[model samples]
Target: MSTIVVDHLSKIYPVAVKEAGFKGTLTHFFKRTYRQVKAVQDVSFQIESGEVVGFLGANGAGKTTALKMLTGLIHPTSGRVEVAGHIPFQRRSTFLSKVTLVMGQKQQLIWDLPALDSFKINGAVYGISDRALNHRVGELSEMLSLQGKLTQPVRKLSLGERMKAELLAALLHEPNVLFLDEPTLGLDVNAQVAVREFLREYNQRYGATVLLTSHYMADITALCKRVLMIHQGQLIYDGSLDRLVDRFSPCREVKVEFARPYSAHELSVYGDLQDVEKQSARFLVQQEGLTGAIAKILADLQVVDLTVSDPPIEEVIGQLFQAGTVAG
Candidate 1:
């Protein structure tokens, strides 16, 4: 069964006219004009249970707005949204209790209190049994390495530490569905990797359905096998991450490692060299040309090793966005 189903969902905000100053405000109180801004327009998709899907779009593309609708933080202007067999906008306690939304830029933990206290508060709100709460907290804390930091005030914890704490709080009730928006934002490289690893492990262990939205391609690449791309509130693509790459990614990048240093003129006969070093050169080759490119390079030089791979996910997404903007 599908964990989430969205049908022709749309969200529109009324833009209120703001006066320049006090005098202007008084003059325009009776003559204000309102503009309609459509944030999400006719977007629809379905996510199967236990599927890890990436929701991708550039800024102002309505990713966060859609997430809010799915989590019952906000109601949709029109259309339907169903999460875990319940209408999310209804804000039913049963549905809310089974889902969690985590935003990296937002904090649910009190700054002055320890994360443990915040977790306890959430536990109370969810009506978790004391014994189960403790066990769940212990498991999540151990998984996220929050052993010592849970007792520290949130303000005293580092960005990464606090993020881990937030994850613990969100998962304390063992939510079956998760909506993560930029959950690794502002985290250092190691911290980002740690969060990514934890998410992967958690998904595997519990078979939870997750929909993640992030500007960081690494987050999507590592956590999602399927990706949905939206542009200007329109669904543009939805399929395997590999297929997204195959359809939009420029081409495979061929890196040939040389046994010895070679000049550029010697490599140009093969393909467009993207980067070069004394003993290695990277080339951009079309999918059809990859094998031939490798063959020609080996036939021409003392090549030690060769590697071929799809263009980076970021580049693929950039191209997708660029095409979208141009089409608009």
Candidate 2:
């Protein structure tokens, strides 16, 4: 069943516009100008229980705005959103207790106080008994590898440690759905891996539905098999990651080394020459032409070695963004 449902959900903001300089500012002060910005428009998707879906977009693409609406922090400008079987914008206690929103750049932890104190506060807000609070905190702390660090002041901990602590605090209430924005942002490689591993294990252990957004593709690549891509405040892609690649990327990369040196222009007939060196050249060949291109190259040129491979995931996604339209 779908635990999170968004039906034509959209958010629009009326932003004030102003001109530069003295005369323009005086005119603007007398006659104010405003523009209606569609932060999210006609966005709709459904998330099944226990499904971890990646919400992906460049900055200002409305990923965060959609998340805020889903978590009940902000109401949508139009359409409907249901999370955990309750209307999100209503902010009822039942709805609030069933979902948690965690933003990596924002901190819920008290800077000067120990994370334990903050955990207790969260428990209080959720009406969790002391016994349950201790048990839940212990479980989350163990999962995040923060058994001994939870007592330390948040400010005293390392960046990675503080992030782990923040995660533990968020999960202390045992919410069924989590909306995480940039959950692994700014962490070192090791820290990023740690968080990824922990999230995977936590999801498996608890069957929690997670909707995550991150600039680090590693976070999405490792954690989400399905992804939702928003572009220009609209949901452009909602499907498996593999399918997204196949839908948008029609070309594969081919690299070859000739026994003799060849210039890029000389090899242009074979494929779209991407890089050329003294003895090696790379080409982007359409999937349907990959076989014919390789055959023609081998038959006509003195080939030393050759290999064909899929383009990088990042490159494929970049092409999608540049195209600015979803595959029909």
Candidate 3:
């Protein structure tokens, strides 16, 4: 079953227009001019129950705006959205209880209070019984590896610990749908890995549906098999992560470490030479020609080692955004 559905979803905002002059300011004060900014335009997609999908976009690409509409934080200017069989903007009690939105840049915990206190407050708000709340907190904290840290004031915990605590609190109600925005933002490498592991485990254990948005490609690569790419507030691509890569980047990077030095010109015969440093060189070779190119290189050149890999996901997505258009 589809846990979330959106059709032709869009949000537009009006911004007051003013010129850089006293006359313009005086006129704006009495009769203002405004321009419509299309933050999101005709975006549509569906996420099945228990699916983890990545929402990809550059800054100001309406990723957050779309999330807000899906979470009942803001009403969309047009189209339709249903999460867990409920209209999100309605903000019904049953709907709210079935979904959770966690933004890394925002905190719901009281800074001066221990996170456990905040959890209790959230429990009260959700009408969870004392025993059930305690059980849920204990289970979630253990999964998050947040043992014994909830007693400290929120401000005293490390950023990673606090992020984990936030996850625990958010999951206390066991929402069936999770909308996470950069849950690993500002986390160190180890912390990022930890959070990713926790999320994977939680999803598996609860069969929760997750729609995650992050600037960190690692988060997307680690957690999502399918991704939706939004450029200029429009969804440009939606499919498996591997398909997205194959579509945008039809070539693989082949790094060859030679037994002897080779000039860039000499390496160009094998493929598109990317760079050469001492005895090693990198080339971008079309996937169709990869096997033939490797055979010729080995047969003609003194090669010590070679490795082939897809272009980094970040680079591929970056290029896609730069082009600003993808064939539908």
TM-score of each: 0.81, 0.88, 0.85
Between candidates 2 and 3, the lDDT winner: 3
Quantify how close model 1 is to the true structure by its C-alpha RMSD in Å: 5.0
lDDT of each: 0.89, 0.91, 0.92
Number of the predicted model whose TM-score against the real structure is largest: 2
Kindly give the stretch of ten consecutive residues in candidate 1 with the minimal lDDT sum. 319-328
Residue 176 accuracy (lDDT) in model 3:
94
Residues 162-228, model 3: lDDT tens digits: 9999988899999999999999999999999999999899889999999999988999999999999
lDDT of 3 at 244: 86
Off by over 4 Å in 2: 18-32, 257-282, 291-304
Full candidate order by lDDT, most accurate first: 3, 2, 1
**lDDT by residue for model 1 over 26-65, one digit each (tens)?**
7668677888889899988999999999999999888999
Residue 52, model 3: lDDT of 96
| Model 2 / residue 315 / CA error / Å | 1.5
